[model samples]
Target: MTGERGRGRVQAVAGVVLLAWVVLFAAFVEVGNPLVLLATAVSGGLVCACAVAGGVVTMRLTDAETAARLRHVFVVLEGTAMAIFYLFYGFAFSVEPVGRPGDFAVVVLLVLSVPALGALTLVLWRSYAVHKIVVDAFGPLVPDSGAGVPVQRIRVLGTVLVTVGLALAVSAMTVALVTPMYRPVLLTVGLFVTLSPVVLGVSLTRVTDVYSARRRNVGNYVIVLAASGFAVSEFASGAGVAGVLFGALVFGAVVLLVIAILVVREFTGEWDRPWREPRGRKVSP
Candidate 1:
């Protein structure tokens, strides 16, 4: 309980800090329009709300498992909020020379908001179902199998991401092939995005069986890579052709950090055991 409280405090602090940073960033950009800044602030506030909500749920819940699932819900919410904020702002910066920021913001908001809405709906529906089941059960809902399990929910999310990413990647590649101004770096970005989801889906699927520690570690690394790719891609898009090398450099640094963390964890014996105790069985100490 003490640990939970500490984590919650940390999340609260993070939310405050993030809100501050967003306001500072908007001021730094010298955005002339008050509405643009207001929109940015609202997005930041939504993220802060998500972060604070996650911590509150974590602290308030007695059941660790349900709390864990709820945390995932808030995490998705935070990501979705931030993604929409970034996509709109990033596209605004990336728009063609003659394009107005107002027009770009409107178009990008519509484009990004649709998928975010669908993703949020799925997350909330699944989370509600899980909460209902767990609450109605006589004891802790030990998810040994089936779609009710948290792992199963993750797999479903992964599957959806992979399917959508693959389709988008294919379409992007087709356009790149026929277009004279196509950038290879953009294609690489699409491939990285697609690969991350595919790797995550495969890794999580494997974990459903024995839940190997190494497999989990690898999955974590893939998640880091995916996040790095996303951040880099957004920056690259905004920076134009000049950002290709910069994005690669940033990504390479992230990869090295992930590798170093893996090595440290391995040496500390963190990955020397199963991720979870075997179902319906016990390990002798």
Candidate 2:
């Protein structure tokens, strides 16, 4: 009993620490903070190791065998994937910190667009799923897996994001209505950021197992837009409009980060399996 309790504690701590990993990576890519990515990856690895060991030792039921195997893979993959993703973004910057948000935005725009231009590009690349980009570029470094995400989990996560987004939208709108402290451009940015998650959540509804790829693809794009993951120091350092924009950006990033975490855990758990199958059909391996 004591051993089991200890293992549960370890797993809980590991989960909390994993959130820090997502925040760092999101900030790293968004703001080009190299230090945040490195620190979180290294520390996340140590905690994940403890979590994996505890899980393997304590899994007692026969039906939980598959879960034990999956949990083990996901924990290790989470740590390793952190390092790979950090390095992937590292290629985007020089030794110097980014001087302007515009430049960073332009670079991201290009990266996101590259996967879509021309025929050959489309053939070599299948879907624009963010994981596909990482795996394709890194070359077999991370295996492409189904993630085997269930319908309910996806909907639940999306619902939570929508709820938070609406809350932020209301608060920001209230502040804007009360006073005209912010520039029109800044207010527009905040308003759009607030709505992005709500839109993304709705998109998830169209993805019921064997939905159209185009519909699901659009959902993925919305997820990326919600966070607009760029460096936030300049926008985040203000008291009025700046503060509102900063809060919106942080909320968006959290939404994106959490979704990524859920998908990756499922992706790494089930290797070489069909992602979503049509009803009344069995997918061939």
Candidate 3:
């Protein structure tokens, strides 16, 4: 289908579904425990807001490829949100339901979905904005096929690793959600699996001359530290060490803040300051 028609249909469908969800939520909000209902309502609202915002952005983009990618991303996100809500309601009201198992699931979905939307937006923007700049800035640094490894191979390897890792992570999450008792182990494995590909991809980008190796390494290290800290905090929380969990959480937050700055700087050309020097400046060896 044409991009325009596709996007219009997506927006219309999303609007109707979200509106129906809102109406149903309003009708039943008073029937359940107030706190549980409140959490579900808020999470559902956030999902709807993100879906709408993503659709709006998709509509505004002039690039057909980018718009299509955004459309698919938001569709998957909205569908996943709806599925989680359905599952939560079904189990919560079942005759032999356990004590609020779906509550944790809904909260986890919300926590994961918001940042996922943001990351999709950021990555899409980065791909479009930096494509030509990266080629011009680093094309000269690339060596001939006889002298060095091919950039295409590096990119392919990175893509393969990322796809495989994400598949594993998603599988882990699926199993974890269905079996709550194994959630801690499954989630921990998924976290590391998801991140390992990211680390490997960043490293591979260095060989492709897309970004400075030093800066890439720095960003990768910071993110790894943050992930480690967060993982440790989860373990601490399970161990009942409140202080350890609090300290690790704070450390991860600070590390993430630093990485966020680095990401902004990388995109803003701050990391390329030396590469973009005046014509007379000596080029890297």
- Top-TM-score candidate index: 1
| Cand. 1 TM to true fold | 0.46
What are the Cα lDDT values of the candidates?
0.45, 0.42, 0.42
Task: Tell me the spans in candidate 2 whose CA falls farther than 4 Å from its real position.
Answer: 1-149, 175-182, 210-215, 222-227, 240-245, 264-285
Q: How much does candidate 2 score in TM-score?
A: 0.41
Clashing pairs in 1: none
- Model 1, residue 82: displacement in angstroms? 8.0
**Candidate 1 per-residue lDDT over residues 134-201, each given as its tens digit:** 44443323333322455455455446545654555565555444434335655565466545545554
Q: What's the distance in Å from true for residue 114, model 2?
A: 22
Per-residue lDDT for 1-285 in model 3, tens only?
246445644754574466456546445533324443443445445545554555555555555454434543543443344333332332222212125532234443343334333433433343333333343445432322212344455555556555654554465455444544435653564466355655555454444333332334444443444344434333333333333333333333333333333432333344344454235633322
| lDDT for 17 (candidate 1) | 57
lDDT of 1: 0.45
lDDT of 2 by residue, 1-285 (tens): 344445445554554454344444435465444543344344333334433434443333132333333344433444343322322232232112356532344444243223212211221111122233233344322233212355555666567667877877776666545544443533565567676667766655444442332234433443333233332223333345545455455455444544544453343322223444447753321
What is the model-wide C-alpha lDDT for candidate 2? 0.42
